[model samples]
Target: MSSAEVVLDLVRSRPPTLGEGRLLCIDGPAGSGKTTLASQVASAGGDAVVVHMDDLYEGWGGLAEVGAQLGTLLLPLAVGSSGSYRRWDWRLDGWAETVTIAPSSLLVLEGVGSGVSLFAALTTVLAWVEVPPELRLERGVARDGPGVAEHWAQWTHDEQAVFVRERTRERADVVLDGRVP
Candidate 1:
């Protein structure tokens, strides 16, 4: 079967595939189709929780503090109970808003590095959304603007370092071009 067919099959049959209290992460570089695909999956099921990590990233805390939250809090909840999370607040530079995560057979978290293994041990799948670097850069530039040039450059460097260490793509269950879906 084709990759989309696989994804469609996996997502459509999610309650069975994911079971209760399992986390599924959809990760990709910025501008890949993570958000859209997560939405599609969530919408397909009547009871699926979708978490966007973009809300969790705020200011210079970067992944460091996010790691703290995941380790100290989210993982434990995912382990023991069905619960919802309040995504991090970027504008206020502190998290104030709480988003409800409905109880469901599938809990999908999307955005950059959502599939990274550190966040949850019981991951049902780690899907990597891939696109050419040129395309990634182009989409990133369009979304963030040239003002983020230095930031983008720095991220590219960090990502390169990370790819060497973390190997996000190699760990993925599925690799998607992401432009098509």
Candidate 2:
């Protein structure tokens, strides 16, 4: 079975952990294919809704504050209510419009910091994607542009710190190879 199929099967086998919603957190370092995995899972699970962690971040240095932001977005959902969060406008360097997410069969939260311990109890599945540091950096810069390499450097450092403290990978239900197509 494809990875997405495996994840969807796992999710379908579990009872809802977030009220009536199944929470699937796809988390890993930048450019580690979390987004791709999320897309696949969301497509496989017809009732899935996805919230990208990139939208919650204030800026390149916003990683540290994401857990609180996640709380704001997830707390209401835990009670079967709609949840909302202000999206960070990267180009404008400010908070943009709020995005609301209603509880669903599967709610996929994808990107760095999406699987922090703070929400483990509410999460039905936590998937960690990983590739080597060199490849991750290469993919990140290629997508974000070479000009942002310095920012990527700092981001790598900050994300590593958060990952170490959270022990996120160790806590995941599945660890995926991001190098897979």
Per-residue CA lDDT of model 1 for 29-68, tens digit only, reads 7677787778877776456677787776664336433443
Lowest summed lDDT across 10 adjacent residues in model 2 is found at 1-10
For model 2, residues 1-181, the per-residue Cα lDDT tens digits are 7778878888889999988989999989999998888999988798899999999988998999779788878999999998899999999999999898988888999999999999899999998999998999888888889988889879988999999999999999988898874
User: In order, how many clashes per candidate?
Assistant: 0, 0
lDDT per model, in order?
Answer: 0.64, 0.90
- When summed lDDT is taken over every stretch of 10 residues in candidate 1, the lowest stretch is 64-73
Q: How close is candidate 2 to the true structure, as a TM-score?
A: 0.97
